[model samples]
Structures are given as C-alpha cells and as structure tokens.
Target: MKKASLYGTGALLFLALTGCAQQSKSDAAAQLNDQSVMALNWFQQSGEYQALTYQAFTTATYAFDKAQSLTGKPKAVIVDLDETMIDNSAYSAWQVKANKPFEDKSWSRWTHAEQANAVPGAVSFAQYVDSHGGIMFYVSNRDQKDYAATLANLQRLGFPNVNAKTLRLSTTTSNKQARFDAIKNEGYNVVLYVGDNLNDFGAATYHKSNAERRNFVNSNHSLFGTQFIVLPNPLYGDWESGLAPGYNKLTPEQKLKVRADALKAWDGK
Candidate 1:
C-alpha cells in the first residue's frame, strides 16, 4: 500500500501501532434505503404521480386564466426537465435493480440514450399552452453536452418547443435566477413555474436545511398551485441533500446514521 501521512508525520506506522485499519468496500456504491425502492415504485406504478401531475396542470390552467388578463408580451411557462416534464423513474428503477446509487457515467448513458418517457400531465399541458400561443421553456440542470440527447428525448416524447432557445440548461450555477431573469428580459410574461425542486422557482430555496426549507415553503403557501406548480419527485431531491452533517463528506455508515438521526416520528410502546 502507498503511504498516506498527514501533518508531516509518519501516521501510517503510528496508526499500525494504534490498531487502526483502513476502510474497504467491495462496491463503489453504498446500499440505500427501501424508501428509494418505494419512491421509484410509486412514481412508476402508482396513480398518485398521475394525480399530482394532473393537479398541477389543473392549477396551472387557473393560473393561465389569470395570466391572460395581463397584457405586455407573449406568455411563457417555465418547467423543470428531469422529474417534472420527463419521467426519470426508469433510471432510478435501473439503479435499484443494479444495487447502485447515482453515478454520473450511468446517468449520462441514460441521457444519451434519450428514451425517457413524459411525466403524466407534461405532454398535454405543454400542448395546451403551445396551441394557445404561449411558449414552454424547459429550464434544466442538464449539462450542455447532453443537450442533443435531451432535445431528442423531449421531441420523441412530444414535448413542444424542444429547441436550443427553450431548453435553458445550467452551465455555471444551479441557481436558476439568471435563466428566469433572461426569460423575463425577453419580454415573455412568465405565467407559471413548474418544477420538482424549490430552486427551480427562485433563489430563496437554495442551501437551506429541511426545517428552513419547509418554513420557506410555508411562507409561499399562496403560490403553491398558482404561479408555482411543483411536481412530486420523492425518489430524490434537494430535501435529501439538505439533511444534516455535511452529507457528501460522510462514509456509508456515517450517512446511514445521519439518516436515522434525522427521522421525525412517534414512539409507540
């Protein structure tokens, strides 16, 4: 084994004397919760995802009615890509089957294949706005390299306005304020913003803890189904990322313990 010593000390020999051993794992990915399985199953097989998606559009229609009254420029509806417009549960399902967590290589392969299905209401809603002369903009975090496949996937799934100008991808920051601002600057009246993550709507949702995020959501309760139509994506989200103890730096065991610690529940004797 190559030596790894910290603080200019021969810590390898010191650790050997102290009976400390290096950690080893058979697989690069860690075992995840059954919740991951359940979430994917729910998204794929259940009527709940359909109900929620349709509900978002039902509210969006109401928002559209309000948007029509305000006259200035053409209307636009901003939506997220992954779980909001296109269903990625197939990717999650593959992960569960392979017993692996999210890996960029695997995700990129899926994106490259460009066969993702549409979310329940996404196709019809996009068509609805398109027929009415309102444009649809997909503001996603997909890298620029994936644009071709992403565009192909959207077109294959029949999402309207699948083009360079409409697909605003993240190049620098995950914060979507600049994209939103750009749409506004183009003289499009952004009627409704649809996404699974809070960051898709505005800046207030970034880097917040679970409690803080919930509080922020509560503060904007009035916008729930109106100006903001959020789709459900329980398989993965910023919510999981916002959990305590610097999750990215944690070991598998450490991460499991953190998840266990963060759970809120009732104790029954």
Candidate 2:
C-alpha cells in the first residue's frame, strides 16, 4: 500500500474508533438504560425498519388470532432475546465503527441491568399474548450467568409475565428443539416462534453452511408472515457464520485467514 493511502486508512480507523469510544462514554454516563423503544422509533424512521416492523407485527397478530380460534389447547409464542426483544444495535454499531471483534467482557460491562429495553410494540405484544391466554416463552442462547440480570431488565421494561423459569437460557440445551419440545410437553401448543436468527425457531444445526441455511429459509417461507417471525438483525447471526463458527479452535492468524477466505468465497461467484 502507498504511504499516503496507508496514512489515510489509519486516520479513518482512528476517527472511527474515537467515535465509538465517545458513544461508549455517553452510554456509560447514561448508566446503560433501555433503548429498545427509541430503537423502534428509529426503525420507524428508517424505510427498512418500517417494513420489518410491519412484517413482524403481522406475524404476531396472525398467531394471536389463530390462538384465539383454537379450542382446547393453549397457544404460545417462543421469542428470542437479544435483538428480538432487546435492542443491542448500539453495541453492534459500536463494534462495526471501532473495527473490533465482539468481546463478551466489554459487552457485558456495556449491557448492565439498565441497558436492555423493549423493542417497539414488544411489550404491548407480549402483554397481549399474556392477556389472551397465550404463553410467551423466551428461548435465548444467552448464558445462564446473565439470567437474573436479563429478567430484571425485561421486567423493568414492562415486558409482562416474564419469569426466570420461562427463560430457556444457553445452559439448557445446544438444540432449541429440546426447549420447544419441553414447552410442547408442558401442554402449551407453540403457534408462533420469533427470533432474529434461523436457529431460534428451527434446529440449531441448520445453518452450518450458507447453502443449507438459505434452503432452510426458503423451504420455510410459508411461515414468513405467519408462525415464524424473524426480526431484522444485520449486525450478526448466521451472516457471521461465514467467518467460521468456533474462533477458539483457531489461532489469531488462522482466524484472520478464515475471515479472508470467507470474503473471497463471498466475492467469488
């Protein structure tokens, strides 16, 4: 690379990191409050968020209506945490601008008890599900260590009927099918499932490859606006699978090579 070009890239990188640091400082000062409601507002302001919100709402509403029509068994909705219920966009945005990989320690420090907030209409929809004899089961991959804090955050945000037991954390099982099956065995008919990731609704091993994942999504397109509700999460999820799933197995240099390979594979055809 030319000296001038390298200097420019370095300068831009510095500026980006500085901007993220400033945002983090502000977040720290604010005591990591819930911003999901505000994020929803921002989503509404964006053409993309607007369309996604509409699709998600339609799916939830349809599920609710179907639940109301059911006679004997009760209806339930399996919801994911993170981007589905809580808005961690700020964390993601910070990571992108800073050009840093996601660090759990840093992320945990940032998303203290006050950081989690409800997505737009999340609280309202959850409450509705509760009121209409629908059980809202939060099936999240978040570690069990964050359980109490997660519950506290959800409760603080007016997310109704959220209990510690209802949360199936990462401690439960590698496959979410176990969780869903547990729910089914408990007598609640799961009519709707919501998440920002594919594995949230389906089996965990569905997205090992890009082709298999796309096929899964297409095959289940019938559920797109019905039982399967997927919220938009561009910052991560299966998209990051291209970079390789397990980073611990690889050295830093190996990780970089895998990332380079992923980029190459993406651009190849």
Best by lDDT: 1
Could you tell me how far off, in angstroms, the CA of residue 69 lies in candidate 1 after the best superposition? Answer: 3.8
lDDT of 1 by residue, 103-146 (tens): 78899999998879998878988999899878999999988888
* Cα deviation of 219, candidate 1, in Å: 0.8
Model 2: C-alpha RMSD to truth?
9.5
Judge candidate 1 against the unseen true structure and give its global Cα lDDT, from 0 to 1: 0.83
Q: Write one digit per residue (lDDT tens) for candidate 2, span 81-190.
A: 88888887667556545554567876775566458657776777888888978888998887777777888888898888889668788764656888888888988878
The list of candidate 1 runs beyond 4 A from truth reads 1-30
Using TM-score, give the best candidate's number. 1
TM-score of each: 0.87, 0.72
Please give the range of 10 consecutive residues that has the lowest summed lDDT in model 2.
Answer: 28-37
Clashing pairs in 1: none
